[model samples]
Target: MTPSLTEDGTLPAPAGNVIVVEESDMVDLFGVWDLVMVVSGVAWHLFTVVIFGWIVLRRHHFPPFRTRNLRLLGFMLACGILFWVCQVLTSLTTGRPNLPRAVCVLISPWLAYGLGLDLYMTILAYRLYLLYWLLVLRYPLRQSRRFYLFPILLGVPTALVLVSATASPRLVSTTHYPNPGNCVYSLMYSALCVVDVMIHIIVLLCLNYLCRHIEATYNDYRETTFGSIAFILLTIVAVNVFIWIGIGPPLYGYLFDREEYLAQFCVKLAADGLSCQGCHRRVDGSSSARLSYPPANPLHQHQYQRPTLPPGTGSYGETRPNDDNNSGQEDGRGTPGCSDSRTNGCRGGDDSLVEMAPTSRGITQQPADKNGHIEEWSLAHVAYHDDESNQLADKDYTGTSSAPHPPQHDRVIIE
Candidate 1:
């Protein structure tokens, strides 16, 4: 009778057309595959990290990676780095004695549970937060008290997935082949995906509604950024399904079942980078960030004496008088620029290379109001600097800058 097992300790292949491969040779196939899987995954994580860090250091980021956002990003990157560090340790213990593998197994789950899921959950949570801002709150992303909801959004789903996955027998088991150590698929991605799908559905519905809402409320807002955000999020969930379907839990049943942590982290890192790029891109192109909006009620248009602008100042640069309104409310908000201290002087994200408008002034924000209400009802569109000559408008025309402000015939906005 043919032996049930091969010499090097793996199940024997089928006898007939299988061509009777040697036990050692066939068993080595799994070890080699694992080596390749990990090397590729680790290398991918490192490449993305280096590339991502370079972008962070060299280029100005939008939303300017500061305040709470900055802290979250810093922690996110740390998670990725530490993930691989733990992975390397766990992997080295493979094929070693029980104590080393046991020690690695004990620590690796918690490390992954704590750090590995953060970026993934944050992506979902931020998406939810964005939907809330656009739909329910109607607040600017940069200015939302709803930031408090973020912890709940992030923590609840992550903890449930971890808890559920660990409870399931499928969480961690023997690696394929004769590998003795219990290596887990990435946080058992299958469990996390249930929450992912639910959130994705809700986000898609909100975005669809937002496209219509933007048309009605804001002047000249585009849905391109919103569309891009939807696509990025959809891609995240879809890729999870693809990866999980392919190399499932660490088990021998599948032809090439393997570890999932490294693979999952690499995908998550790349997705986060794309999402960040999408956020920064919102400020560019024909975006109307610089222009102020008309009053919500046409009947209540506020007006003041038209401030003098130098003759050559771009035609579009001058503010329009409100329709059918008496002049002289005694402008509380002075003309915006360096000339007026009372005005909201040119201010915005300090890290602003990526946010330059056509004037190249970079991204800018209106000064916060004293009553704590943001008067910038216009999206407070990006604040812009008038041409050098225009800043001297209050001065004599003859004293205008020698270079002369050119007429902005090319620049036009439809009221």
Candidate 2:
């Protein structure tokens, strides 16, 4: 049976007109501090919900509760709600104090008892996931499946022990007290917090190992994506540390004073929200920048033109023998023939036009050779013999050399 106290130091009339004496020692439940806690708690909870909704909407899946950051965020929101409930209960039980003190005293115990523990657990889960990933990634892709079984075996037992120890009814009552602020104390709760710290340490070490493994595996890719990701993770760790250090102990103090809880929650709401925003930058650059190169510099673009080569060369601009009539037989030793009709020195029209063939602006891809080898030959290698006089004069001498000059006397031919 619950005790209903009347301020007059006697039980109120059970059936007659009873004056329910309001104790001056007891404060009203609604006041400035409670108003702040309600506002801040409501705002943060909504912010978390909005972010979570965005994630789910973007991914079109159940919100990723398993991810480390997201999971921590969820836990924080949950803790906030739990703290709110505790404040409400305290208000109800302690003859309804003014808002701030009422809220603080009620929510303090839950915050002290479980909030940090929850965050610590979240970090541990994430770190363990990272460790598993590293172990899997360390081996060949085919053998990674062999490494996955260990997490389930280890994780289940650890979780079971933590949950069973904390959730016991006897343990729940020990951490709380009845003098306006109730707290339950049990080895389970204490052990849980200790485990949280230890696990967080382990996870932090695992994160270091995971990052080292990533650096080792992808030495080149580490500079760009890895740095960004590392910054985000480090930021998360920093924020976690701030909260662990900043909000943690104060929460215990607030368990005895509702006003303090509201104040702390309000301050935390601002600081942590700002920290989250700073930490959550998109990893990839903007979509437009990712898909396209930056605009070309107009001033620099005008400085260069495609170079021309001697006559009778392939599209790659390499000089071929006059007798090398097989225009399509581009082997691996040489570059692929240019397909642009403007550079028709081999079989098409004006050779001069080939030199002036408008270059592909964004990218110039080399065609594959006869053996399917693609060589990106520079534009300077192709020749242009658009002049009629040069064309007619070179047309009569078809021995092998594309140039009108005779073979050097020092050149030796064994064939």
Q: Which candidate is the best by TM-score?
A: 1
Model 1 CA lDDT for position 249 = 52
Model 2: lDDT to the true structure: 0.41
Error of 1 at 15 (Å): 37
TM-score, per-candidate, Cα-based: 0.32, 0.31
Candidate 1 residues lying further than 4 Å off, grouped into runs, are 1-44, 61-114, 127-136, 139-147, 164-415
Q: Candidate 2 residues 1-415, lDDT tens each?
A: 7567699877545555433334575545577866776689678878878887687457545433333345554565565566565555554445442333223422433453345344434544454455446564655535567555644543553455445544554444421222222344467655755665565546545555555544433322234356448868999998798778877777675566544343333323332222112111112322110111111333321222334545655434433333123444443333233233323422332232222121122112233346544333232222334343354111111122222221111111000
For each of the candidates, the C-alpha root-mean-square deviation to the true structure, in angstroms, is 30.4, 30.7
lDDT (Cα, tens digit) per residue for candidate 1, span 1-415: 7567778988766544323323353222237756786789788878877876775676536543331244445566677667666766666654432332234334455465445545544553454455556556776766656676655654666566556545554654444312333355455554565555466455545544544454333311244357558879999988797787675653342234222322222223322332212222112343222222222343433321233445544222333223122122222232212222322221222211112222221212223245533332111122232332232111111111111111111111111
Candidate-wise lDDT, in order: 0.41, 0.41
Clashing pairs in 1: 289-382
